[model samples]
Target: MNVQSNPVTASDTNARVLSYAEAIREAMAIAMQADPTVILMGEDIGVYGGAFQVTLDLIDRFGPERVMDTPISELGGAGVAVGAALTGLKPIFEFQFSDFAMLAMEQIVNQAAKLRYMLGGEAAVPVVFRMPSGSGTGAAAQHSQSIEAWFGHVPGLKVLQPSTPEDAKGMLLAALADPDPVMIFEHKLLYKTKGHVPEGSYLTPIGKALVRRTGSDLTIVAGSIMLHRALEAAEKLATDGINVEVIDLRSIRPIDRDTILTSVRKTGKLLVVYEGVKAYGVGAEISAMVAESDAFDYLDAPILRLGAADAPVPYNPDLERASVPQVDTIEAAARRLVRREV
Candidate 1:
């Protein structure tokens, strides 16, 4: 295996687009190529080539030692990754599905997340935990939960949910270099969806939100799959003379409160959208932030929230569609907030 051949340095020229999974693979390749100390560890990541093939061709390039496949114990695999990270080896751990991360919560949130802080900043756990999150594959409730809120609540962990291919690659690269624990929530539906990603290595700083669309009527704060829906809704609302600004909260933890507040103050109205259940979801936190910030006084209307219903992700496509905030739901929510119609 030639690790030096797959360097991940960014070029000064144009950036080429890539798929979400390909972007992830690119980050892994670059990281391993850039630093020999980086290794991959997870279940089915070796000969099986990963459950979603995100680690495809990596084992062939780095061999079994660097691209090791472990038993199907999330706890054990995660713990091993943490121990490796503590010893100066950058271990990228893959959780087959976000739902399975629950089984290793103690290791992830308690151990990996707290190691540096507990050690008085003497020890750092530079591990990137990647998991396929969100619903769309009919994976049922057990396999289709958006658990970003759970980890975002933890103090020592950084939670990232990139909505585009560019960010998928950029964020992963940045997370790999972070000195603390980082959890990346990769949307399952976006794996095959193609987009233009930078051709070489780059980093999108964590904790900064991006304004996807600019407008003055209302502001929509969203993340993950819901970001796409918010953009679609903004376009439809534009025709009705409503100018809506869509903000993508790419970094859930250490969220960009300044950017969010600035947008809401200009728009005078706010609508927070997320894919998780309405109660205590990302939207709730965003809405509260706006209300507490100076942006609250500039609101022309109450800060509205639209989110998934508090129920299991249904197996039926129609039922599932209705359970979450789809484009139509987002459109309606935007229109209502803009006073377009009911």
Candidate 2:
């Protein structure tokens, strides 16, 4: 379907249909062109053009010096990025996959995050680390893990996950501008999906929630690919006289609590959905916030959480689908929370 979007005028009609990966590359291109200090460092990012080819053609434009490909060492490479950021360069590091970030947990969680505060604002690390996350591509147990909850627990660190093309561009720009370290968890499945993104420079403010859909009956909070799934479930639920509000908690850390509380107070019902395991995911955080806030009195039903099981992401396609929350899972959970029988 040809979707009508806000179009921006360019010098030529070279408006080629671009994927999410291309949108991200465009953001990097624009940022690099604007600032010489913004450099990319990661394994295969320079010559191999990244494991996902998201950094393709960047080396040719910026040359090998700025676009560097390091050895197969997450911890050492992350340390390099931290040192680079300390010495006045904005380094954008790419972990081949989200699971690899665990190898560099000390650099990210302790040193990079606590530098400014520990030194009384003497040292600042303006860095953006990109980690392709989630379990949709059959990457199995080791390569796939939704560990945003881990980063969100740390102070002075921003954790962002973009669910759309526009966000993919906007959030990256914002991450580069932050004085502290920002960890971006881009889901693997969203790479091929396309959406109309604005031309020229743009930035989506960090620590803000986006209300994707407006309604009065119920509010559904989600992030990453699950945000799109919740929006789909909202459309189907609408046909049955249920109006659902969809909130995309774009930034997991320093979450937009006001937006969430306002939505719950207005809608009176809440459903939190995500692809991460339910035990300690973003859903649990939001659920606890609502329970403790004044919004608790406004709840018409118990806050519901729909997420992956505690087990590892299965290799089998059927079990994989069953492992995480999908459209049907979201729909069923919403129905039960709203007291609607399917």
Provide TM-scores for the models: 0.94, 0.95
- lDDT, candidate 2, 93-131, per-residue tens: 999998999999999988899999999999999999998
Across 1-342, the per-residue lDDT of candidate 1 in tens digits comes to 000111122323355657788989999999999999899998899888898999999998999999999899999999999999999899999999989999999999889988888999999999999989888889889988898998989999999998877788889989988988899999988887776676767898899888878899999998877888888888888998889898888999989999999998899988898887889988888889888888889998888888878899999998988888888888887878778343
Instruction: Pick the lDDT winner.
Output: 2
Q: What's the number of clashes in each of the models?
A: 3, 0
Which pairs of residues collide in model 1? 17-196, 17-197, 18-197
TM-score of 2: 0.95
